[model samples]
Target: MNKKTLLFTALLVFGILQSGYTPPEEGMFPLSELHKLDLKKAGLKIDQKEIYNPNGTSLVDALVNVGGCTGSFISNEGLIITNHHCAFSAVQLASTPENDYLNKGLVAKSKEEEIEAKGLTCRITDSYEDVSNRVLGAVAQITDPSSRLQLINNTMKNIVNEAEQKDPTIKAEVSEMFIGKTYVLFRYKTILDVRLVYVPNRQIGEFGGETDNWVWPRHTGDFSFMRAYVSKDGKPTKYSKDNVPYTPKKFLKVNANGTDEEDFVFILGYPGRTFRHRPSEFITYQQKFVLPYTSELYDFQNQTMENAGKKDKRIEIKLATRIKRNANVMKNYRGKLQGLRGIDLIGQKKQEDAALAEFINNNVAEKAKYGNLMKDIDELYKVINGDANRDLWLSQIYNSTSLLAVSRNINNFKTALDAQPAAQKQGFFDQNINQVKQALSNSYSSFELDVDKTILKRMLNDAAAFSPQQKVNAVNKITSKGSNSAALIDQFIKHTFELSKLKNQDYVLNILLKNPKSISAYQDALLQLEQDLNKQIAALKPEKDRREGLLNKLMGDYVNVKEKFLKKDFIPDANSTLRLTYGYVRGYWPADATYMKPYTTIKGIIEKGATGNPDFGYPETIKTLWNAKDFGPFAKKDLNDVPVSFLYNMDTTGGNSGSPIMNANGELIGVNFDRAYGATINDYAWNESYSRSIGVDIRYVLWVATKIDKADFLIKEIGIKL
Candidate 1:
């Protein structure tokens, strides 16, 4: 069949299914809604109270939001388990040539041996309450979009303030769900003294590396362990030698028996974002323009880092975390773009939207409320399509330049200094001095002049690619002279870096500390360039804000109307909110004649090892142990070998990495790290047939900790279960 025929067939099948279609039990549903689902029918073996309880500690209490990734307590002593990639930044921060944790790995044999994870923090949800009535009441009278937004913000701030005043140690925020249809207040206990406990070498943790990322039948370990410490008084406190290991009220029990296909499973984590309910125009704009544009920018970044890393190991160490992050995003976007086409997402979304439009038009009151919503939203996208591209390019350019970012930090301090009262000027200057010092310290620690030069040059050239109507004059002027050629841009970068005060440590320090007055104090070539770019953004801010306000108002109205019209408990889009998604342990058929098993065993690792790529290669000791057929008790009896990774039909996204995948009885079964390439489309549309979350099996984690690393203490600490 031709492409169009296949799409038409698929659409027909989908429409037929829709008549009786149960919303796939595949959603990141809020905890409160768990009671609404028939747990027995859906294969759940545990009660909703076991997972979440506002009055008492439950499974949710064991989960931690770790550096934008999810983690869970595995021991009462606060041993936390998360993905290696999730802890990548902390590992990278603690790494150096003489004692590179990334290369050699870490094993804190005792509590005293554990090193602090600087600038890392974890929070456990203390409570989540519905506050929709209160929030809506506060903004009921507001009509103007800006005023409405301001009132909502103020109300949320007041709510948060009251909650915080009750317990200074807790952090609270009010988040809107279903757009503005619902509001929830989440309170969390912030733990600051996180410590590195264990991390495997990259050869093991990041076994498949970028090549095998988001692919199926993976061998990547992708797991790490850390510990949270509290003050001697047993309260969350900053890193200090006086701190003791935190004792979490609850923790997950490891189930070493592993799971079979169709076994009930669930995931609890903060899913970053999902556009499943977004309009077709939004999806089309992203597929056609945004993804391709950002993908190219990421490609440039990856190549530059690779080129620079080959010459300097320090560069390799410094850029390892960034390169991995960029590559993941690039590949995800590419996969999503392809998946959207493969499923004819735009076509499907348009059909659904058209049907909904018809439904709205058929009713008089509904017509008055939502008749023009889709049309208005489509027009909004058209108005800002080119601007979106330009904004993304500008953002990439600003972020890629280390010196520019540093300069902006200094400018922020200057702004703060000027904003303070005259009597409080000295106190303000003193308070900000430490911040400036830390900022400079952090900037230089990972900053490589040569790498930044390469990025700056490439960014300028790419920025020039923006159409004349969308182009910024500063970028255009620089590129027009060189015709956006690499060599000319290179020369410009070299000259600018050499002449800029930002190049010298003493000059940067002098400007940042000597005069806490204005950004004008820094008469640097790089600063001038930054100022020019800032001017362009400043000039566009008013129009941008106006457009954004209109879009938000329209979207909010659309969501409110749709939720009532549908008469279903429609969950809001994921916005880094804690959520739970459940499914069965299952594999999928990605194509016509191929069916993949739910799990991959140690034997597959040996088979892939023959490829000889560093990503596929295993550590020598691990290989020897596997070769000897040394299957420990952690090995699955059915498989007769340890399961390395497994797949399940659970919904997940970026921030879901490191989430603990639990079995029906709430035992820790795996650590979610990636989704299959075809499943990338789940962010937009979930297809149960293809969508699956891949996780490193808990048995593999145990085997590695006991047999390979011989982390006997950790194994004993967690205690075994089957």
Candidate 2:
């Protein structure tokens, strides 16, 4: 509204239009590419080298891949800070009815009290190098699309294998930055001895719950702490009592002073996949098929689990994490559907693609190189869209339940064991059966009969209603055997559970592991159904692989043509790799006559908590502290309340959760958590206006850790006293 601000905004837009280049907000720029941007001009107070210096240690080394999500080492002792949701499974694993660490917050007073986070691993990026020439060069002579893809895969594997062989402590991965265009080899330092340091209760971490998830003006804390450990010699190793806290080469310092609106910020972490560069055909499929299928199915699953949980406390605890994850994704898909429809991203992509096609055809040289690109891509999509419905439904079967997932895995073990030579059969089992047991143990630990029965029943119903051409044979077998569909489903469930004997952990671990062949004698109805579905899936794999191969081969050309038409540097889409996305802390109107501020405070939590909604649940101590005006050093002078979370126009996606969003001075100001609901479209497209990312402000994190959780020791450990 101010004259100076209005003039600056106008000029910025004009410059962007004139240059035909991307703004800083649109792409998750890789660490290697940070130097290409004018960081200081963007209000970055520190040298770009401080963020990522190829020749020496820098802030990039502090970033962590906490499994699927991102985190950062905040202390020399490998104290990692990440989102509560990222550590959901770990907390759930440690929680039980009598000792509910989830409901009641946890803090380790000393290293002795820290509990092992089973199966959790924290990976710190050691370094990354471009391997495009080596990967693509090896497959240049291959003419067949399938053969070329195979060779590319083999070459990438060889590169990773060689890297890991050189250093056994490192875990290496070759990520394709662009399909058939570029590749990067990232080597990571792994820590298996990860342990929980501090975890806020559900009321704090998940404030506003699913009701406010992905919505802006958010007040969710959405943060937790864990630490990584290694052997005494500073080498990566699994959990052991003798292990010591792993000293990181670099770590981020907390900026408890926090930030305000219009402040420049950037985030470095592993962002999940994005399809912004994909052609219209891909966007259309995502909009019409993938999004709908996943959202609706997840909605049904969450509802089923919720209903079951309401009846049994045990079932509630067992399925809590699964439901939370499913519901989060379900709502996110629904938001994407809203964004795609509301913003017309699909329509926008179609227009851009049309222009690209025109550009390709207008020039003789370009036409010769890409004449059939558009048509070939359309044809490929046509085939995919034909079976989109059936294929989507079929893909969900393996992931439908823990039981089915285990069944498929163990079944593979059985198949492999049976295929070995008679002399080597026992040897094979001796080598592989333990792996099967470990997999089954994880599945069986979380397995619940009620939840699986409900999901299975729903899956069968979906399959039964499919078109005649897309019929699921397993469902058909039962439907044909009986006239009443309900009766058949019931009978199938009854016999499957009773006959399988797999519900018994002893039987599954002992008898099944010893002789997988014995499982078939039971002739379980559900197992038989799974076998039938596997056969169908097996029959479909080759055609699927062929289509995928062709698409992969063509996409490189597609990207090349688009770049030529635009005459701009093409930012590669996110693929769960380390990337840096930057922008200012800003706000925008989500709708007509409605503007959302960039920041929220503890006062918002109080107002939402009073609404009697479970999602906005809060502990009584928070109200007590606020009522008494026991504001410590954390309160903001202007607002007279601690800032809870702030919004920024940075490109982020699923795996960016728990990433440290840094201030201009390269200090941790907040932990990136969610995006505005409208910004869910960020995975497909981005704009500075609506594509805002949210972070739990470090001030709120400090206040909660100190006053509420009584974690003064952590305050001291992090070297920030408040």
Expressed as tens digits, the lDDT of each residue in 179-296 for candidate 1 is 5557898988999999999998788899888889989989989999999999999988789999888998999998878787667788999989887767788899889888888887
- Where model 2 places Cα greater than 4 Å from the true spot, the runs are 1-25, 482-487, 515-522
**Backbone collisions counted per model:** 1, 0
Model 2 is weakest, by summed lDDT over 10 consecutive residues, at 516-525
- The TM-score of predicted model 2 comes to 0.96
Each model's C-alpha lDDT?
0.82, 0.86
Model number with the top lDDT: 2
Stretches of candidate 1 off by over 4 Å are: 1-25, 418-424, 477-491, 505-507, 510-520, 564-567
For each candidate in turn, the TM-score is 0.93, 0.96
Q: Give one digit per residue, the lDDT tens place, for model 2 in 358-474.
A: 998999999998899999999999999888877988888777777887787767777787788878877888887888899888887668887788888888877777778777777
lDDT, candidate 1, equals: 0.82
